[model samples]
Every structure is written in structure tokens, then in C-alpha cells.
Target: MVEFTDWDIFRNLALAARWTVLLSIIAFIGGGVVAGILLLLRMTKNVLLVGLVRVYTEVFQGTPLLMQLFLAFFGLSLLGIDIGAWTAASLAMTLFTSAYLCEIWRGCIDSLPKGQWEASRTLGLNYFQTMRYVIVPQSVRVATAPTMGFSVQVVKNTALASIIGFVELTKAGTMLNNATFEPFKVFSLVALFYFAICYPLTRYSKYLERKLNVAG
Candidate 1:
């Protein structure tokens, strides 16, 4: 076995962190697009769409993210579509993130006073116009913190992607450990790297909560 140095471990893990970040970004964008549509569906008075979205939200939110990844991995392959680990991980995370984000945004939109909607309509605006021009702008302030905070969860959840053969940060660390036989130091660094990525976002989430409270 080739001897591994601290720099060697750092180099490999840092390289893998790129995928972790990239996967998170793709999932963020994909989930946001899907969530936007769901938010629109949620805003409507259509009982069927609202109920459909409710079930969609419940199914994804209720299930473990790990199962989602597994299905995307082995489950899809069983159907004769041989996808890569990256594709599988991305699909799983996108669906998982979308479900949570839909609810978060729906709550933000719901929290707005009915008068905002009434006033917009009173100004000759239609439903879409009211949401786009008036309601969405205000709800953005309410949504910003939770949206960002959930991003942290999105990043952390990528760790689970390793179970589906994604060579992300966690899997890279495990590989390094097997090579160097240094589980303690290897995994400790993994934890720190995750904290380094997530801690600031968490603090900022709390900061936004306070700011919004004061604004309210």
C-alpha cells in the first residue's frame, strides 16, 4: 500500500468536496423550479391540485432520504436504465429538496395577510399579477431564512449519497481511511469539513429569524 500523507488525505477529500457542493447546487436549482410550480399550485383554490400536492409533499417528506437514493440507484437500474451514481444522487436530492421547499414557501405565502391579496386585486391585478408583483416580493423576506437554512440540510444530505456509490466527501473519507488505517483522524476531518460548510449558513439562518421578527 502506498503511504498516505496529511496533504494526500486533504487533497483527495477536498477534491471530493467539489462534487458534494456541485450536487447540492444542481439539487437546489432543480428543486427550486419544481417547488415554484408546487407553490403556484398551492396558491390556487383548486382543491384537487392542493390535495395532490399535499400527498406529494407527505410522501417525500414522510420517507427517508436514504430510501429515495436507493430507489434512484438500484431501483431505476432494475427498470433497465443504467444510470450513473451522479444522476441517481441528483435525482433523489432534487425530489427530496423540492418536497420540503414547497412546504416552506407555501407557509411563507400563507403567512401573508389576506389584505395584501385583496389590495392587489383591488388595484386591478389578477391572481398571477398579484403574486408576482406584490405577494412574492414580501414573502421573499419571510422565505429567505428558512430557504437558506434548508440549504444546509441539502448539503448535509449529500453525505447520504455516498450510500448510492457517490464518491462524495463522506465516501472519500472512508476510502482514505481504508487506505491509511486512520479512522479517527480521517472521520474527524470529515466532520469538521461538514461543519465548515454548514456552520455559517446556520448562524445566518438564526440572524434572519431575528431580523424578520424585528421587522414584524
Candidate 2:
């Protein structure tokens, strides 16, 4: 049996933590682009498009992330796409993250006073101009805190990527546990690494919320 010292466990988990960070970046950026598009679509006064956005958001938010990852990993392979765990995990998380993000942004946009839009319209501002100049600026102020809060959730959800054989922090911990038979030691660091990543985000998000509220 191979022996794992405390340092060894720490060192290994730390190495794996890098992948976790990288994946989180990928998901956040990719999800942002997608959510932006979806938000714009929802804003449009089209019944069919609005319904479609609603359905997309509900389907993703209603389902478990694990199942999404599984489908992305296995389902793609079935179609002979030959995607790896990394690609699959990223795809699933991006979609999942985008759904929530769209909701957050839409809620932010909607939170603006109806008068703001009406005023913009009276000023002869078109839809895009109204959003760009008036509505969006105010909405962003409201959305900042919530978006930061949601980013923490995205980071935590990266742990789910492990189930699909991605070598992120959780997967690394599991592998180390099996090899060393040290579940407590292994998973403790796993949790700590996650906490290390998430705690600051949590604190900062709260800070932003307070700061934004005060300014507004």
C-alpha cells in the first residue's frame, strides 16, 4: 500500500485545485456570453422567443447538474463526437450557468422602474438605446451584488464536474482517497480547497451588495 503523508495530500490537492480554477473561469465567461444573448432575446417583445427562453431556463434550472454533466459526457460519445470529460463538463456547466445568469440579469433589468423605460421612449430612444443608456446602467447597479453571489455558486458547482471523470479538486480528492484509504484526510482538504476558493467570493459579494445599496 502506498503511504500518503499530510503534506503529500496537501500538495496533490493543491495541484488539482488549479484545474478547478481554470474550469470555473471557462464556465463563467462562456456562461456570460450565452446568458447575455438569452437576456436580450427575453427582452424582445416576441411571445415565441420569450417562451423559448423561459423553457430553456426552466429545463436547465429544474434539472440536476450531475445529470447534465452525464448527458454531455455520455450522450455526445454516443453520437460519435469523441468529446472528453473536460469538454463535456465545460459544456454542461456553461449551459447550466447561463440559465441562472439569464434569470439574474433579467430580474435585474426588470427591477428598473417602469418610468425609466417610458422616459427613454419619450426621449425617442429605441429599445437598444434605452437599454444601453438608461435601463441597463441602473440594472447593472442592482445586478452587481447578485451576480457576484451567483458566481460563488458557479465555483461551488465546479465540484460536480468530478462525477464525469474530470480531474478537478473533487476528482483528485476521490482518487487520492481510494489510493491512500484516507477519506477523512483527503476529503477534508477537498472541502478546504473549495472553501479557500469560495469564502472570499462570498465575502466580496456581500461587500458589493452593501456598497451598491448604499450608493443607490
Candidate 3:
């Protein structure tokens, strides 16, 4: 068996963690864009469009993300569309993230007083104008804390990408453990790395919740 010093493992894992962070950022941003479009469509009050958005959200949110990753990685091959592990993982993560964020943002928008809509209408603002000038601005504050909290989930979820052969922190740990036969030490460090990345976001999420007085 090849020997791996603790420092060697740490160094390799830290390098791999950069990919984890990058994947999470890409997925989260892509998801936000998709979620924003869905939110706007739902806001249009078109029954068909709203129902479609609801079904999309339910389909993604109700299913296991692991299954989604598998499908993204394997299913496309059946249709003759080739994709690498990174592409598949990014696609799956973006779709999964979009579903939950859409709901979170929708709930925030709905929580606002109905009178704001009425008042905006009285001022002769159309649906788009009212949303842009009034609803969206107010809802942003309510959404910020929860959005940050969801970002932590996005980061943790990147580990699932390892199942498809993405060389992320978890995958690196697994590779190192296999090489050195040190699952305990390797995985403990892996968990510590994840905690190091996630804990600050978790704490900051709580801080925002408290500061915004939006805590449940």
C-alpha cells in the first residue's frame, strides 16, 4: 500500500475542495437564474403557466437528488447526447436547486401584505411594474437569510456529485482512503473540511434571520 502522510492528504483534499466550491457556486447561480424566471412566470397569474411551474417544482423537490444525478449522468447517453461527469452533475444540481429556491422565494413574495398589490394597482402600475417597483424590492430582505441557508445545502449537495466521478473533496477523500487504507483519518478530515466550509454560512444564516427578525 502506498503511504500518505496526513499533510499529503490534507493538501490533496484542499485542492479538491476548490472544485467543490466552484461547482456549488455554478449550480447556485444557475439555479437562481432559472428560479427567477419561474417566479416571474408564476407571478403572471396565468393558470396554465403557474400549474406548470408547480409541477416542475414538485417533480424535482419530491424526487431524490441521487436519482437525479444518476439520470443526468446516464440517461442522456441513451438519447445520444454525451456529457461528462462535471456537466451532468452541474445540470442536475442546478435543476434541484432551482426547485427549492423557487418555492422559498415564492413563499416570501406571498407573505407580503396583499394591500401592497392593491395600492400599486391604485397608482396605475401594471403587474410587471408593481412587482419590479414594490413586491420584489420588499421581498428581497425576507429572502436573503433563507437564500444563504439554502446555499449551505448547495455546498453539501456537491458531495453527491462524487458518486458520478467528479473529483471533489469527498471523492478525493475516498481516493486517499483507498490508497492509504485510512478511512477513519481520511473521512474525519473530510468531515472537518465540510464543516469548515459550511459552519460559517450556517452561523451567518442565523445571524441574518435574527437581524432581519425573520426567524421562526
Clash counts for the predictions, in order: 0, 0, 0
Clash total of candidate 3: 0
Model 3: how far is 184 from its true place, Å?
A: 1.2
Model 3 ranges with Cα > 4 A deviation: 214-216
lDDT of 3 by residue, 140-186 (tens): 98999999999999999999999999999999999998899889999
Candidate 2: where are CA atoms >4 Å away?
214-216
Q: For candidate 1, lDDT tens digit of each residue in 118-171?
A: 899789999888878998898998899999899999999999999988999999
Model 2 lDDT per residue over 160-189, tens place = 999889999999999999999879878988
Kindly provide the TM-score of model 3 when superposed on the true structure, using C-alpha atoms: 0.96
Winner by lDDT: 3
Clash pairs, candidate 2, are none
Tell me how far the alpha carbon of residue 182 in candidate 2 is from the true structure, in angstroms, after superposition.
1.7
Cα-based lDDT at residue 76, candidate 2: 91
TM-score for candidate 2, please give it.
0.96
CA lDDT scores, all candidates in order: 0.92, 0.91, 0.94
CA error at residue 210 for candidate 3, angstroms: 2.5
| Residue 142 of model 3, lDDT score | 96
